[model samples]
Target: MANKNHSDGDLKGTFYLVMALGVFIVVVWGLCFGLFLDRF
Candidate 1:
């Protein structure tokens, strides 16, 4: 039971990590895209 709980926590941590990374990437991409548009 303890091991299962630990694994569940690990899974949740991994999910949050992936979500944060995805948001970061999207924000960066949007900034770059906006700058690119400004050039025109």
Candidate 2:
């Protein structure tokens, strides 16, 4: 039972990390795209 709870916590942490990384990527991409439009 203890092990199961620990694994669940690990999974939740992994999920949050992936979500944060995805958001960071989208924000960076948006900034780059905006800069590209400004140049043209």
Candidate 3:
């Protein structure tokens, strides 16, 4: 039971980290794309 709880916590943390990273990548990509459009 204790191990199961510990693993659940780890999975939750990993999920949040992946989500944050995905959002960061999307924002950066959008900014770069906007800049490219403005330049061209």
CA-only RMSD, every prediction: 2.2, 2.2, 2.0
1-40 in candidate 3: lDDT tens per residue? 9999999988998899999999999999999999999995
User: Which pairs of residues clash in candidate 3, taking residues 3 or more apart in a chain or in different chains?
Assistant: none
Q: Candidate 3, residue 6: CA error in Å?
A: 5.4
lDDT of 2 by residue, 1-33 (tens): 999999999899899999999999999999999
- Alpha-carbon runs more than 4 Å astray in model 3: 1-7
Q: Lowest lDDT 10-mer window, candidate 2?
A: 5-14
- Candidate 3 local accuracy as lDDT? 0.96
lDDT of 2: 0.96
> Which regions of candidate 2 fall more than 4 Å away from where they truly are?
1-7
| Angstrom error at residue 33, model 1 | 0.2
TM-score of each: 0.73, 0.71, 0.73
